[model samples]
Target: MTCGYARAVERARAGSARVPLTRASAALRRWSQRSQVTLTAVLLLVAGLLTVGIAADPDWVPPATFLLLEVVAVFLLRLRPLAVLGGTVLVCAWGLWWWGAESITPGFLAVLTLSVVAIGVFARERQRLGLRGAPGDRMLVDLRDRLAAHGRVPPLPAGWRVDSEIRSAHAEGFSGDFMVAGTRAGGTTLEIVLVDVSGKGMGAGVRSLQLSGAFGGLLGALPREEFLGAANGYLLAQAWAEGFATAIHVVVDLRTGDFTVSSAGHPPAMQLHAGSGRMELLDTVGAPALGVVADLRCAALTGRLDQGDVLLLYTDGLIEARGGDLEQGIDRLMGAADRVLAPGRGSAAAVLAGVRAGDDDDRAVVLIQRA
Candidate 1:
């Protein structure tokens, strides 16, 4: 009976060990299946490093070292592959020239062989997964998510509601238009900014992202009148070779309904009178767009929103249709607002949708109402 118990205990311990091993194997398999891109990147980088290590003189620090670093950089740092592929090609050429007709090290050859296998596996799995476009497209999707997160509207104060909508010219990637709305830490003040970067496509999208980061940081942090100036200063500091941005910045007191708005070469905001049922244009004279000139000045217009009044802010894209000019666009928007903007009837997005422009430029609109 004692011998039998000992054998049973040993068997139990062995089973438990095998259970953990089995779980580890399953986890590794899952990781390998899901990490095809990462695995391919690592293999490529390691193979490049091995090539450099074998071809370069043992005493002389080779240029291939820097090339290997760039490979690691493009892999780990998530840089555009097309942008850095030229450098990689140069390194490969150097390796081939140096090691031509020479037998490669066993380890180097093994790494190259493994890299070939990894590429094949990556290709097969990518096809199985129906991966779209290149790895750069995946990176762009991540970038778009980050930009959207940063540009999202934060929670507003009670009794005040804000709504916005943005459509990019392109179907995917990022947009050159963005809006940000949030209340201050004290909760007594709320601020909103709608900006449109010049140009379109990926270049403008990138600039919009940079400006969004800057403006997001300035919102509610600076005084009402100083925010635009600070943003202008930041843009001037960047010295972007040729692009500018137009924006509207508004700050409102949650309790008093007193608000200050400033413009930077953007379209005029509109105000809907609660009692008169008339749409009034809030076209404050301000400085040129950001990055237009150094030490640019912006003027802030102050007003109060009585109960039931509505404020409308929008980008130029809202008003500039293919055939219609700014005046016609503004008229159309006001007409749409007058029709849809009844008390507790419609939202900013609704108004924007009602006055949609025919042009392809990106559009952003914000509607603020006081309870």
Candidate 2:
């Protein structure tokens, strides 16, 4: 009975040892598979060194030099294996001609042949793993490029100067806030839309991108009063369960300086009266946020922009901060505008930099002045 128990315990220990051995074998196999190309290159180098050491000629240095170059190309520089193989072939041919075939050993030839085959296998494996080609990356690049082109500020009409600034919370190349400006009806009227979608980072950026395209089309074709309604209707149609956007749309008649402003749950715009030198909020009636209500009516506030008057349109991110007061943010922005645009000394970029709420939210500001 004692002998049987000892045998059972020994069998258990043997089984445990086999388990670790199996795991170690699997890990080694994975490592070798991953480093196949590197191992081939090292083997080729070693073969060359061995050949040089055995050769009787005191001037047998070409093989060593070629091996060093191959090491740099394969291991350090990470050149494509096919290109490196081609170069190696040329070098080997040159060495054969200069130092005679006696300088090249059978071992060197064997390793060179194996290295080429290994490189081919490595290339095939990399292609299978989707590491050699950039199809997905190429598509993303094209999409980002198109988005960047669309994000640019549109051309403005004469007697009106526009400047804008955008800052993203994630500090990414794109922002959740976007602005589009264009001249409509034979350059007589300027239509502009500055919008901030809900959320932040890439998710909000994508939504902003989609809405920017939709809003750009609406601004170009729809009448000033119908723009926000059309945009809200489009948003509702998408059936976004938890998505809404705040926007301000303005259309200015360049010949008359008469402008109509509309809002959809957005912060009020500030108008710097050129005559009074006072900044007052444009009292525009708002509707529910886009995608929030089905029957939304956005009322417009009509105002006239005298020469040298400035209009500031911004996203709520400029006034909303974590653990802070929204009214205080507005006051700071107003004061900054007064100082920056006092004598038109600074630009929209400077004003945004000065009065930034310093929070992790996307911000956008557009400054339109009647020049």
Candidate 3:
């Protein structure tokens, strides 16, 4: 009997040892996937750029030299994005200089476009990997720093904890969803904002940061209604210069167990009750998207929260994800919400997962509960 018990303990230890090995193996596989994806993306970008250059300037370089340089650059780019960007710029500059007297041809324009887009994409990835910089990289750097603060903020005054995550899919564009939460007025009110910016890539990303900054400033100043109005004004100001951004912002009062919301061209948020599977889409009776109109009065919608209830603010990207219909995506999100907001798993991470899975674009979720 003693020997049998010892053998059982040994088996359990062996099983535990295997679990970490399995996890490590999976992690290694994902790393390999990222490496291959980076290599392939760089290769395609180089090929497209070179093809355009050759088409634009037929006599730019001797064939042997151009081909040789292309091969060498591709080989170097597997390890260095700056090298790739440098090579592209040099080749493009050389081609343009060689064809100085000729009109810029369609092929040249195409190559230039490819070079710009590829550089942007590669720069974003390289910055993520601690490699290099590009135009607007500072904005990305600011965004990254803010995102790293998710779920790390102080607890809500009412004793509710904030849960959050920011993850970019293996693609371009801002999945415009982000969450911010903190105690207000020394724990009298709980302010949480879940916003989704319209558009994708750099433009969408820029707009998202703008919205977040606006909301952050307002969360500490005005009442929810005034904050909504301010958000509309901010949007209008931005729209006048560019086009527009859609967003939903909310302030939850832990003292009164009530919440106020203001939305601008953003999807209606939802609330999942703490105990049951019931869900209700919050009122989004706000004005049109920000930047479209000035002095737009955003309507303030209100609701009450019982313990275990989750308020979810998300972007259309969740509902209008590419691979599925809006209804299907919403249904999937609702289902996920039902599972995560269920008793015992009541945290920000739980709700974020529900919304994250539905994202085909920028996505975000915020959850606040009573202490």
Candidate 4:
């Protein structure tokens, strides 16, 4: 008890020590943002002066080098987009008027014009996003990283191998498909929830992060059967017009190879039997797609994995095709999976990479193997 108390006190002290550091970091970020406009103005002024110097002495440095100022303006945009854009225009116009036919040759003018157009495009994109700099993109990256943190499978005892992977539509940095996992009873029970948020790619990114965090907590805190109902409740509370989702919640007993699975309007998971090298669907049905209906009628599906058996969980994005049936998509996927998850080749990542369907949406897969 003394040791526990001592450790708790140490953690409290360490946490307290970080307060000042957090405040300092936040203050520093505010200062940087507040100074961006001034910094961009200064940079533009310097670029203008440098351009004048280089243009006046064309012999020292080629007047064509003045085009480099436009490139500099692009970098300055992260500091302040509209200001940098207006300043770049003024500087370029003044230089063209001051030097005219001599240093501001047609070739130089052409390159500068193209660079300015590119900068304008970038500025418009930033404006559309209502973002002044790279912070928005960085925030998305951080959230994606956090979601990945929750998906990490806990270290289990020998004879159990579990792995997962996801791909966003159009090669985005984040996806609507994500997984959150938890372990109970000293890592003997592994629980995984694979969710596919409505929409795809970056369009569904924010919702994915929000629900992943909510479900991650629920998975760790709630009973295996209570997870979907609670997740549905959480989503319903959000009241987003399009906040519907489909999820598969699974719990695996590492020691006995016994598993229980359930889904909320999600595609079925598949099992690869080690004996006959056959893949069979779990065919478990539950409530309607999450957030769609208030009344949920979820039923638990139970099964056991013999030695060398493999269970595969995936998002619809992996098998779905435009203007095609869902079951057909599953058939094609299983055929490909059978070959990929065959006795010699036991890699879920390989199966995901090999199957070439559902490119229009995000795809994710989790494989549990009893070795």
Candidate 5:
């Protein structure tokens, strides 16, 4: 008992000695997170104000100085950009009234007007969307990278490569089309889901981001037969206004060159057999898109990829157009694939670039080539 108590006392002393350092480190981290950006903005404003106030001629200071500071503050103090904007405007207006009351300074007035607009937009975002900016942007960066990284199929055994690409509508930063892939069973099995969320570009960015993360987690969690059902259930639960989405699920056995595919109202997946050099559809027709119906059971289609064969999965944006039908788009894509890929050296990005149909919409293409 004495030895145990002595040992406990010694351990307590050790932990107590480290507590101060741990707390100091945490305090430093918190300060750095907010201090760096905030400090930089404040220092910039102070320097600008000092430079203008001490100038031999006020005119030489430039009336646009505060405006530049306001703009910089909006990005720097994005956590409360409007506050920074308001403060800047008030300071500028006050200075104009006190120092140049008789002067008609259109520049400061213009800055004030622009600040009001920024404030209004930020107000709308807060009241309607309840979204706020924070240092959590680091978290968002990680998530965005996760969404892109998951699309890269895990390193395949020799002689196999999966090439994928995604482009947002209007060439924006986000797209409705995304894919999540994983390998299981000693890296011999590869599973993937190519999803097209309801909207396009940044309009569907949030949905795409959310679904990509969820689908990535579910990629190898459930049995192959239950993967789609689970994803369908998840979407239905979201119950969003424009919740329905189309997806193609594929599972391949790398060793055997066998794969099973299923669709959720998505465009058909195309396969090119090296032996025939013909592209064929591998779609389970008549299945409903995700979140369209509950307890949906989609039919699966099976296929094989021989040596030098390729499989293509893509979003509707790559094909759908005004007054265009499904088969029409497929036929056009087949012809393009034959011409571009017939050389046996084409890539997914090449196929995406060669196709001219989806210029007005977001486009994504994934090519699984078995070399």
Candidate 6:
């Protein structure tokens, strides 16, 4: 009797060991078990109904064999994807062959079509979610590249003095309204460009970043005329250059206070008189935008920016912002510059904060004040 009890105990342990489930594995095991149970119940119900219907038919093949084959096919469902696909295809082929010898029910056709569609759809979704190179994946990768370049540049000029700050209403993305990079070259020449890429979101944002990089590099290297020419040439060469970005390129002389500006499809930047708070829109007459043509000449016009005067470079997003009067917006911007830029303090923050408060679209401001 003891020997018999030992054998029985061994058998019970073997059965329990077959399903080696631990607490950590319990959820997955339960889910799989439930699925198996539900499938088994469904198969049994289907087989039982088929068996009952076939029992009365004198000319039909044996229901037992058909049910056996179905049970075997059901067991193959847990195989790897390719194997499952092969087995399903084979089963479908067999069903088609059987249809030639037997009556094909509407239910069988419906189930077969549903199974194939479900498998295809589910497989596609899983593959897309798992892989690293779908259209969405490419866009995500492009987005990362775009964001990585945002406001990323070498710090303020080395030999030249500078003041700069960035404030964003939305942190993750920019709406294409951003400032110009101005470098004081020698005693008189000052290089600056106010850039606005065509649209918003990752696509336009990426192009804006590229445009800035190209423009900045050219700003530091080429002469005023050559730089403008090369910039337009490069823009027009872009594969998707859609005549989009609008910009203003300016070179100012600190000694003589003489400034030269050229615009291409961009909103004219404003000049603010330091004491009187007068605002004037710089010249807008120039060639078509950079990407629109390769050989267009940008007319350069010169003016004087005296001491205690401020040059305000702005984008269309600010001037075109609706829900408020445009003139009032300009007045508010000018007023804030005068207020926040108290006697000793340069009011750059007041300018940016004022724009942030009033304007709706993306706003970028570059304030040039000779201290």
Best by lDDT: 4
By lDDT, the better pick of 3 and 5 is 5
lDDT by residue (tens digit), candidate 2, 43-161 = 45654554455344536554444444443334322225545553555455446645665656666666655665565565555445333322322333444454445446556666778
Deviating ranges (above 4 Å) for candidate 1: 1-135
lDDT (10s digit) by residue, model 6, range 1-371: 25643443344334222322244345544454456546545554554455444444525634334434443533323333323443444354355446552434556555555555555454455345432112223344444444334334333322322233433335435446444454545434667676777766545655665666556555646557666666666677565745467778777765666778888876566676656656666766567766777676877776777666666666655555467776676666656655665342565556676555633345566666654
lDDT of 5 at 314: 88
In angstroms, the error of model 2 at 67 is: 25
- Higher-TM-score candidate of 4 and 5: 5
Per TM-score, the best of the predicted structures is 5
Worst 10 residues of 6 by lDDT: 130-139
Q: Give the poorly placed runs of model 4, Cα more than 4 Å off.
A: 1-31, 50-81, 84-88, 94-131, 134-137
Candidate 1 local Cα displacement, residue 254, angstroms? 0.4
lDDT (Cα) of model 4: 0.75
lDDT of 5: 0.72
Order of candidates by TM-score, top first? Answer: 5, 4, 1, 2, 3, 6
Candidate 3: worst-modelled 10 consecutive residues by lDDT? 12-21
Against the true structure, candidate 6 reaches a TM-score of 0.53
Residue 292 alpha-carbon offset, candidate 5, angstroms: 1.3
Q: For residues 1-371, could you state the per-residue lDDT of candidate 1 as single tens digits?
A: 25643443344234222312234444544554566567556645755765566466534544334444443433332223322333454446445656672433445545544443444454445444433224433545555665676556666666777777777774445688887666785777888888888887677777776666667666665667767776776777677875688888888888899999989998988988888888899987567998787777888888988888899998887789776678998999999888888655778678878896754778777788887
Query: On residues 87-111, what C-alpha lDDT tens digit does candidate 3 reach at each position?
Result: 5655554565476625445565566
TM-scores for every candidate against the unseen true structure: 0.64, 0.63, 0.58, 0.81, 0.81, 0.53
Q: Model 5 over residues 20-127: C-alpha lDDT tens digits?
A: 223444454466456755665665566456445534355655545555655554433444545655555566556665665433266657666777577657655643
- Candidate 3 has what TM-score? 0.58
**lDDT, model 2, position 171:** 78
